[model samples]
Target chain A: MKSIAIIIKKELRRFFTDRRLLISVFMPGIMIYLLYSLIGNFLFSTPQSQEYKIAVQNPSATFQTVLDGYMQSEEVKDTYSLTVIESDGQAEEKKKELENKELDLLVIFSADFDEKLALYMQGVKPEQLPVMQVYYNALEQSSQSIYTIVTTLYDAMESSLANVFEVAGGNVATESDGFAYMLSTILPMLIMVFLFQGSMMMTPESIAGEKERGTFATMLVTPVSRSAIAVGKIIALSLVASLSGLSSFLGVIFSLPKMAGMSMSGLNIAYGFGDYLLLFANIIVLEMLFVALVSVISAYAHSIKEATAYSTVLMIVVMLVGMVSMVGTLPSALWVYFIPVFNAVVVINQIVTFSVSALGVALTIVANLVCVALLVLLLAKMFNNENIIFGK
Target chain B: MEEILRAEHLRKTFKISAKQRKIERTEERCKVAVNDVSFSAYRGEVFGLLGPNGAGKTTTLRILSTLIGADSGDAIVCGCSVRKQPEEVRKHIGFMTSELKLESFFTPSYLFDFFSELHGVPKEKAMQRKQELFRKFGIDRFAEVKVGDLSTGMKQKASLVISIVQDPELIIFDEPTNGLDVLTAKVVTDFLIELKNMGKSIILSTHIFSLAEKICDRIGIIVDGNMIKEDTLAAITEKRSLEEEFFALYAQIKGENL
Candidate 1:
């Protein structure tokens, strides 16, 4: 144990002193935050154009008056600035304009507008109704608003018709805020990616790098058991990997508002200082398991290149498992809590979503620790095998 | 003098697959690496295992260092049988190789301290040994610099310092001066002499005969996994230079093969 501590201390000092390692660990945090923020800015910021050009063919004066009244309504003006093109040729020209993405949506009112409006009021499918050909050349928030406005107009035409001139108002319930949705889903996945990336980059460099630099053989000849050296390396790598994991978590937290465009005003991502501490604890365990796995792979390899190749494939497999599990609904099987990398993704997802059960978290920790122990032992065995150690 | 390291009829046969192509089925058989070789190093003697590349010098060193188990062998290091008491053997021996690498991120002081503590040296004693070694090896000047920043010679010195920090009963070095500059090689050769004089049994394996000729009390020349000749340097060089005797042994073995 004392020897292990000495080894760990030496490893930590080496890690801290290495500029390449420092950058490899921390650069992802900075880059991930910057990339997500840029993407979020593009996703949510309102575009400059607000016009919805509609082409109408010959229409009754009353329908034209209603259309003009609907266009002037506060809701329509707030959501879209409507342009009525006069002729079919003009409508075709406007359709081309909309196709070219000059307009958000194009509403064509034909000669059977009133007839189709009646049919739509009678609960006929909107797509089956011959009322208006609504051509939305662009998909945006305003395009959906225009569809809703047209539906309400059809309903009013069959009823008292007075409500057609009145704007529909009142907030509707949303499934969840964009940030909350993203926090529940995307953040967990990003954590998984970041964790894997950290492990893949650091573990081989920790073990095979030491071997390449001649430090590993120096450690092996000491009185320290091969197991102890393996443990010490796993712990050192886990610490560095966990640091990177925590940095990624913090990066997401700090970059959330900028990336999601939704104010974190009332939204708490459950990743506060306390959560950060817990996350660090979780990450330490996860990283140990990851690094142990990597160490075994690296120990089997003779050089850094071979180790890196093996680790890269391992990391990809782990990442893919995490990714597939993230997008798919959580499996209810109790055994899923015992699988190594898969279990980590499930636990992290639960933690991010604030739905983690104590039992599930405990199982994840226990299972991962057991897996890490097995891998560490395997690595020790490999270390003791001269054929593997000397690349025979 | 007590025998600090011994091997009796040691044989290490590696199972190598004879595969002509990647997809072909292959047969496996024992390809001998160390063939029925036996030798002993007594206290205060610098024993030399002289061999060309692939002559099983490393395999012998590794087996003695407890890094691997021989297929059929009994070895003892400082009264500990390597087969049954490897941990004890590890405790009693200090092993170094030019093939082993030093971590570039750590200073020599840190590496020395790490190995000293690892080998169960008390902190105060370890620090004392560290200071003495740093000064003796001229490593104190760069003790604070990251090992990666040091020259190859400095790294080799650091590696040697760490290897010998425990001051074990037996010290094994395989090609210790393989990559050292002339000055550094001289330092290492002189250091091995000093260690031998201090009553530590040493095994120096290298292709360089001149250094071994100067320091080794007894030389074992291995060729093709076999110890072709084992004798005192003076006995082997009787009426001939060390280089002539080395080649004469090689030529005689080759003539037998022909």
Candidate 2:
């Protein structure tokens, strides 16, 4: 234990003594914050609906009145500007215009749409079900938004004919800016990405660098157990790497409101301090596992450059694993906690969304600890092997 | 003089690929690095292993220091068998070589302190030793400077200081002054003599004939992984110049191999 403390102190001193390393340790967070803020600003402030151009064919009084009312009701007026096409030839020309990007959307209502709807309101089925042909170019953002709004408008009109009110998509849940949802959705990927990257940044330098510089042989010659040396390095690396991960996470958290938009009032990103602590614990464990794995790879390499080459490939593999978070929330399972990089991603996702289980967190920690212990043993064995330690 | 280290026919071999084999193209290969090597060094004595590169001089020292295990026989250091009690051997030995470079990022003082703790030296004793050695080697003036920033001579001095910080009973140095200025070389030879006078057992390897002629009390000439000659320095240098004798023996071994 005393030897381990001395080893840990030495490893940590190497990390904290270098000013350049200190900056690099914290640089990822500052950069991630800046990057995410830029993306959020772009997403939040970029043109949502830039005056969608729509052509209507064969407008009816009931449909017109409902559309006009919706257009005037403080939401859609500035968004949608409409033109009426009287003839079939004109409707065809408008369709061409919509395809050519001259128009954002086009709606061809059946000539007897209002008439058939009135009959339908009287409990009689209308012929052909009052077909409405909607046209919009999928390539245009404005057209997509207008399509959803127009479809909602028609649904409202059809419901009014039956003297019933309906909500868009029947999802009466108030529209959210998805601020908290965004955190839940994106935070896991970010955390996994930064944790792996942070471990990569320093782990190779600690183990392989020592081997290359011949410092490791000095340690091996000492009477201290090789296991103590490996443990000290892994513990110090995990702490340092977790700091980098935390830096990135804090960057994203502080910049989230700017990304969720200032206009989105009461955005519920209601994760308490305990939840963050859980998330940080998960990050620490994940960092430990990754740092140990990277250190082993680094030890296997002949030199720092070779270690870096091997770890670059491992880094890519880890990043690909992080992509599992982007596949969305997984159904909770005991098996979910058994996957290495993925389990931490899942747990962080659970923590952010407030759906975590006590059991899942425990599994993540225990599973990672087991794997880390196994890896540290492997490193100790490596320390004993002259070929590995000397990189002969 | 009390014997401090002994090797009894220590042997080791390494398997290698026959990539250089042109005719047979067979991969079966092995090189016996240490073959039945035997030697001993005593307190108040400097035993020098004199050989050209790859002659197994380093391997012999490494075996005695327990840096590697012997394949056949064993070495005893301070009454501890290297194979069964390597950690015990390590505790009583200070092994140094160009291969065991101090980490460049560390200051000399920091490295001294680190190795001191690792060797289980109490803080106060380690500090006293550090002050004594650092001042002795003139490393005290730049003890806080990172080794990478130091001159080559300073780095060599720093390596020497850290290795001896434990004050082990047996000191193994491989090619101790292979590359150093004349003044620095003099410092190292002077230090080895001082260590010998203090009743420390020292095993040093060098191919430089002049270095061995200057300080070694006894010498062994190793060739092709075997100790071919062993005698007092005065006995070896009785008639022919040591340099001429070395080449004569080297040429004789080469003739035998061919």
Candidate 3:
């Protein structure tokens, strides 16, 4: 135990005293915050809408009154400027203008449209109503917006003329609930990725770097057991890597509002102190598992560069597993909680959305501990293997 | 004389990769690094294994130190079998070679204390030993400097001191002065003599005849994974100088005129 503590102290000293290593471990969070903020600003700010041009033939006073009322009420009169023109039988030409982008939309009605509409409003069901032909270029954004608004207004008017019953209180979800749902899908994946990246940054340097520099051989010659060395390294790496993971978690928490174009008010992110403690405990154990697994890979590698290259494959695997949080729902199968990286990602998703179960958390923690113990044993065996340690 | 170490028919072989075969320009798939080699050293004696490069001297030392295992035989160090009880063997021996390196990020003092703790030395005894050894080697002046920032000689001295942190019964050194300046080499040779006078058993490998002659009480000559000669220094040099004797033995093995 004393030997393990000494080794841990030495490793901690190496991590805390080195400026370059410290910067590398903590830089990802700062970068993520700045980049996410920029994206949010760009996405949420409303862009200037272009003025839409519309030409009408055989215009109806009733329809014009409805359009004017809708536009005036919305105070968007500057967005669409309607021009009334008499029927010149130039419908095809006007359509050509719309396709050419010169006119945003075109509206045409039959010559007796007012008479047909007046009969229809008196509860007389006619064989057919006057046809209203609308033309707009779907490729143009302004044209699409105007077409949608005008069609909506016309439909509303038509529905009111034939009203029988009404529907009320359609959607009950608040804006905050919607935002929380959005975050639940993405934040879990981000946290897993950050945790993995943090482990990768330090594990290779501590193990493979020592081998390459010949320092590991020095340690191996000592009377201490190889397992002691492995345990010490895993414990120290867990603490250091957890710091890195926490930095990224804090980054996501503080910057999430801007990224989602919303305020933190009423968001379901408020958890109790016990909940946060559970979250951190999960993080530490998960990091230990990561460190143990990476240590084995690092031990197998001949040098630090090779170790880093091999660890990338693990990174990709973890990323694919993390993306499981973005699915429709977290897996309810009890056996899934026994899987290593996948289980942690699931439990973290559960924690943030306030759906975690004690059984699931317990199973995940136990499974992670079991796997970390196994990997540490494997690492100790590798450390004792002369071929693996010396690359003979 | 009391025996401090023994090797009985030790042998080690390595499988050569295709890439290595290409680089070495050889078709052999396996290389016998050490073959049926045996020797012994006693208490309060400096036993030197002298041989040419690639003659398996370092390989023999490594096997004895428990860094690597022999395929066929065993080495007993301080009454502990290296193959059966490697950790126990390690506790009784101090092994130093160019291959073992100190972490450059740490100061010499930190590493010294760290290694002492690993060897399970008492705290006060370790500190006293550290002070004595550091002052003896002039490492006290730069003990707090990082190993990487120190000069090569200083790094070698620090490694030498840390290797003996436990004050083991047997000390195995592979080429103790392979790359040192003249002054540093003198210091190392003088230190070896001092340790010998203090009744420590030392087993060192070297190709330099003068170094072996200067400090070695008994010397063994190895050639191509084979022990060619093992005798007291006076016996090996009775008819010819150590260099002349070595070349004569080499010529006899190669069947060449010299």
Candidate 4:
């Protein structure tokens, strides 16, 4: 225990003193905040334009009336200035124009649009009878306006036809832009990246760097147990990575609203001291797991460069997994709850959305602890292996 | 005299994969690295294990220090079996290697204190030991400088100070002065002589035969994982000069091979 404490102190001193490591930890969060804020400002402040070329297919008089009404609406007039074409082929031409940066969007009205419009309002949704298809090649600011215009037109047509057909009003739900949604989509990926990056960049240097410098051999000859050395490294790395992870979490929470242009009035991100402590505890366990895994990776390599390469590949894999989890819902499985990186990502998402279950939190904590334990064991085993320690 | 360190038929073999002949179409196997060997060092003596690179000098030292376990032999250090009581063996020895580099982030004083504490020396004792070593090695004048910023000689002095801070019964140094300049090497050599006078058992492994002649009470010349010669310097250099005797031994081994 004493030896482990000493190792931990030494490691902490090294970490605090290394300028490169200190910069890596803080720079990512600052850059992320700055980039997000700039992008968000552009998203919210930019005016919508409707220089979109759209095609009308065999337009009837009533269809023309509806189209003209949309063109005249203040929201539409403020957002878009439309150019109507004759056919789908012409719409495709407009799509090519948009692809070549000539147009913003392309809208196609199919031949059966009038019939489909009638059916769409009469409570019979037209899946194949395409009333309009808007195409934008990229995620541009104007695309949001295009989506808004299309949805508004569809809703108007539906309500009018509902009156004629005497059908029940189909109330459509709008998407939420509050804390829960933001937490679900962005927080998990951010946490995973922060934790993984911190571990990848710090843990290897703590172990393999020592070996490369020849300090590890000197360390082993001390009265320190192999287990103690491993534990010390794990603890020091966990502290560093967890602190960086927390910094990143705060960066996202504070900068996200400004970036997304979403109202922060109803967003209750202000947590009590107790909530902060709990969050910190979770992050600590996750950091320990990642750090231990990195230590094991460091032991596998003979030099700092080799260790860095191995750790980079591992971080990329973790990031890819975290990203996939962000874009989709996590699978509910007991086994999934046991997987280290994946479990951390899932729990972080749940935490952000304020939907974390007690069972899930407990499971995640236990899973991470298990991972740390196994990795420390592996490291200790490696330390005892003559081939590794003696560099044979 | 009591044996401070002992290895009996110590062996370590590493299997290498090779292509098999036509009939088997399987990977053949060959054993590489350390083979069976044995030697012992008595208390209060400097024992030299002389070998060129890849002659298993480091491997033998690792086994003795409990850094690694031998494949099929037993080593005892300070009366503790390395195979069964490695922790105890580790507590009795200090190890330094030429490849082991100092952490540049810490001052010499802090580095010594850190290791003293790791060895479970009391805080007051650790401080006293640090101060004493700093003064004795003349490291006190620059004890506050980060090790990385220090000269090579200073770094080596710092390394030795940390290694001996625990005052273990046995010390193992593998090519401890391999890269030092003449002045730094003399300082290290003088320190080793001082430690010897204090009755510490030391094992110094090096390919430099002259280093062994200077301080070693006994020398074991190892070649191809085998100890070809083991004796006191006086006995080995009975009539011939140390250099001539070393060449004669080398020539004898070469002639046997031919």
Candidate 5:
């Protein structure tokens, strides 16, 4: 145990004292936070306030009332300023303005449109009921948006005039459920990737780099047992990876609300302290599994470069599994929780969404520990293998 | 004399990959690295295994040091069997070789303490030994410098100091002076004599004939993984110079005139 402590201390000192390594450990989190914030600001910022220019050949008071009623909503009230211009035998010129995007919309309402519409609703149909022509440039985003809004209002007005039945919809999910659903989908993939990346940052260089430089043989010639070396390295590396994972976790958590265009204050936070405890416990165990497995792969490699190449393949595999599991339905089977990476991802997803079973969590933690033990054992055995250590 | 180490028919073999086979232009799948090689060293004596490169000198020392396993034999170091109790054997011996390199990032002082802790030396004893060895090897002036920054000779000195941090009874050095300048080579040769005088059993492997004559009490000539001769330096040179005798034996083994 003392020897293991010594090894752990040395490994951690190597990581923490090196400025380059320290930067690598913290850079992922900082970069993620900045990039995600920039994306959120660009993709989900509130619609910009703008004015819409409309040319109406024959302006209708009824249509104006419809637009006014729709604009009363708080979200749209301050977003758009409306202007009405008479066509006055310049319809072609107005179209030219619309084409150039100088005009937002052109509405040509027939004379006596309200009267004809009233007559039509009273079952006295006129020769060709009053018509309205709507034209706007599709090439301009603002013009397209206002055109859609205006057409939607007209459709509603037509539906109300000849209404036989009404349809309405409401979301049954609470605000907290919405937030949880988003987290359950996104955090698993990101966290799994971040945890893997964190392990990759240290394990290959620590194990395989030692081998390449011939230092591993020096360690082997000592009286320390191989298992002690393996355990010490895994524990120390897992601690480092955990720090990185935590950084990324914070970045994700703090940036998520901004990305979704929702105020974090508006969120109905559903997770309790116990939920977080379970999540973090599983995460730490999962990192151990990752570190152990990477150490084994690294021990098999002759150089750090080779180890990194092999580990990149494993990283891709991890990413594919995480991404697929994120979109697929969660498995409730007890045996599913006994798988390694997949199990941890599922358990984390369930924990965030508040549907995790006690048995699943227990099985996942047990499975991760078992896998870690097996991989560490394999690593120790590899350390003892002369060919793997000395072979070209 | 008390026996410090014994080897009975120690052997090791390696599998040649297809690429290596092509490079060497050989059809054999396996190359015997050490074939029925056996020799012994006594306490308070420096034993030399004299051979050209690829004569299995390093491999034999590696097996005895417990860095590798023998295929069908055993070596006992300080009364511990390398085959069965390698960890125990390692505790009884100190091994140094070109293959065992210190981490470049570590200073000699830090590495000394690290290896000393690994060898389970008491803290106070380790500190005293570090001061003595560092000063003796002239490594004290650069003890705080990283291994990578040290000159080749300085690095070798540091490695030598670290190898015996446990003060083991037996010390096995593979090619101790293979890559040193004349001054550093003499320093190392003098150090071996000093170690021998202090009652430590030393195993030295080298190809230099003069090195064998200078300090070795006994010499074993290994050629093609076989121990061709083992005797006191005086007995081996009684009939001819060590170099002339070595070539005569080599001709006899290869069935050619030299």
Candidate 6:
């Protein structure tokens, strides 16, 4: 225990005391925050929160009665205005304005007699539904709002024709499920990436750097067991990497609201504290796996620079495996949980989406820790090899 | 003098890859680094292994220090088998080599405490010994400065102080005065004499004939991984000048290699 503590203390001192290393550890999180903010500002600034404009052609008396009933609410009045124009030329002028971003929407209805609708209502089926053309530029936010508002008013039309939508069965997707799906896909992939990055930043220096600078030989000459040294470093590096991963995670989580604009409400996460506990537990295991794997690469490498290069290839491979689970598609087999980093990533996705099974989560944690143990053992064995440690 | 260290027919070979050899193309290869060399040192005597560079002197010391294992055979350091009880062997040895570098980021003072703790010395005793060694070696003057930022001599003194933190029964110094300025070299030589007087079994490997003559009670001349001669300084220098005899032996070995 004393030997392990001494080793961990020395490693932490080297890691925390270097200002350049401190910056490198924090840089990924800061960059992620800036990137998320920039994307949110660019795409969803909610341009010009203005009232809607709707142009209507000739309308039937029945439609007018329905519209009046739908527009009785005061909030509806403040958000939208109906301008009914009978002349084709005038409606065409409004359609042109809609395209130019001046008007919000244009609604054109075919010339209709009330007798034609009455006949159709009396079990007389028409070959086609009455023509209604709704025009709005999808790019403009106000136009989109107008489309949604006008469509909502015409929901009365759907109620009149009960056979149309039929509004059947429970919806498989909740309104919040969209946000959960997004979180599940994006965060796990990013978590895998940032965890790897954080571990890579320190492992190469802690292991390979020591070997290169000849400090490792001195440490080896001590009475401390090689396994003790390897275990101490693995735990210490895992902690530092976990800290870095958490920083980036918080940056992305906090910036998600800003990135999503008014729809940030979707991200409110119905997840309770238990889900967060599961998420954090998975992250801790993942950090251990990553630190162990990177330490192996560092041990294999002759120098810190070579270790960094080797770790890049490892990161790319891990990210690729992590990407495989990014879509949150159910695995083809339960045995997929046996694969190391990929299984952890899938488990993270499951946790975020609130779709994880207790059995599957347990399997993932066990498999990941198994990998970490194997890697640490391998590193200890490598430390005993003079050629590997002193080859450079 | 009691026998404190003995190495019996220790051997080590390394496999070099083509990429490591920097050749365009080649098969895997092996190089014999240490070839069945053996020597012994007593409880209170300085034994020197005199050799040219690449003559496996460092490899022999590394084996005795238990930094590496011998391919075959073993060394007994202070009654501990290097192969079977390496950790025990290491606990009784203090080794300073070109390969055991002080971490540059730490101050000499921090490293002193750090290495002392690593050596398992109790804190109070560790500090007392650290102060004594630091003051003795003049390392206290720059003890607070980072080792990397210190002058070469200061770093060397700091390194030596850290090496002997446990005050082991056996001391191995490989080319102890290799890269020091004259003043620093003299300091190291003097310090080594002091260590010898304290009754530690010391093994110093060096190619400088004078360093071997001045400090070593017994010297072994090694060439091409072979120990050609071993004797007391007086017995070895009896017939001819040490330098002339060394050149004649070196020329014959060079001719054989060619």
B-chain TM-score for every candidate: 0.91, 0.91, 0.95, 0.90, 0.95, 0.90
Which stretches of candidate 1 lie above 4 Å from their native place?
A: A49-188, A253-261, A269-283, A324-329, A345-356, B17-28, B179-184, B194-200, B251-258
Candidate 6: tens digits of C-alpha lDDT, residues A138-216: 9898888767766777776656755644665886886577667777777777888988987987899889999989998
Candidate 3: tens digits of C-alpha lDDT, residues B16-46: 9999999999999999988899888998899
CA shift of B152, model 4, Å? 1.3
* Candidate 5 global CA lDDT score: 0.88
Off by over 4 Å in 2: A46-188, A255-278, A316-360, B18-28, B179-199, B256-258
On lDDT, the leading prediction is 5
User: Which candidate, 1 or 6, has the higher DockQ?
Assistant: 1
Per-residue C-alpha lDDT of model 6 across residues B163-247, encoded as one tens digit per residue: 8999888889988888778977886788888887777778999988887878788888888777777778788888886776677
Q: Compute the lDDT of residue A33 as modeled in candidate 2.
A: 72
Question: CA shift at B98, candidate 6, in angstroms?
Answer: 2.2
A205-250 in candidate 4: lDDT tens per residue? Answer: 8788887777887788776788888888888888888777766766
TM-score (all chains, Cα) for each model: 0.82, 0.82, 0.86, 0.79, 0.92, 0.81
lDDT of 1 by residue, A114-191 (tens): 766666657674565455566664355655565666657756664663344656686563423445556656665667
Chain B TM-score of candidate 4 stands at 0.90
lDDT per residue (tens digit) for residues B108-157 in model 5: 99999999999999999999999999988789999999999998778888
Q: Candidate 4 docking: what grade?
A: medium
| True-vs-predicted CA distance for residue A350, candidate 5, Å | 1.7
Query: Which pairs clash inside model 1?
Result: A213-B101, A213-B102, A214-B101, A214-B102, A215-B101
Between candidates 4 and 6, the one scoring higher on DockQ is 6
For B122-166, candidate 1 gives per-residue lDDT tens digits of: 889998988888898789999999888998778777877788888
Report every candidate's CA lDDT. Answer: 0.77, 0.83, 0.87, 0.77, 0.88, 0.83
Q: Over 4 Å off in model 5, which ranges?
A: A56-63, A69-73, A77-99, A106-141, A151-163, A266-268, B179-194
**Top candidate (TM-score):** 5
Per-residue lDDT tens digits for candidate 4, residues B139-171, read 998999999899888888888888888888999
Candidate 3 deviant stretches above 4 angstroms? A46-167, A174-180, A266-270, B22-28, B177-199
- Put down candidate 2 lDDT per residue, A274-342, tens digits, no spaces: 887888788888889989999999989988889888878887787776666677557687898998777
True contacts kept of each: 0.86, 0.73, 0.82, 0.84, 0.82, 0.80
Worst 10 residues of 5 chain A by lDDT: A77-86
TM-score result, candidate 4: 0.79
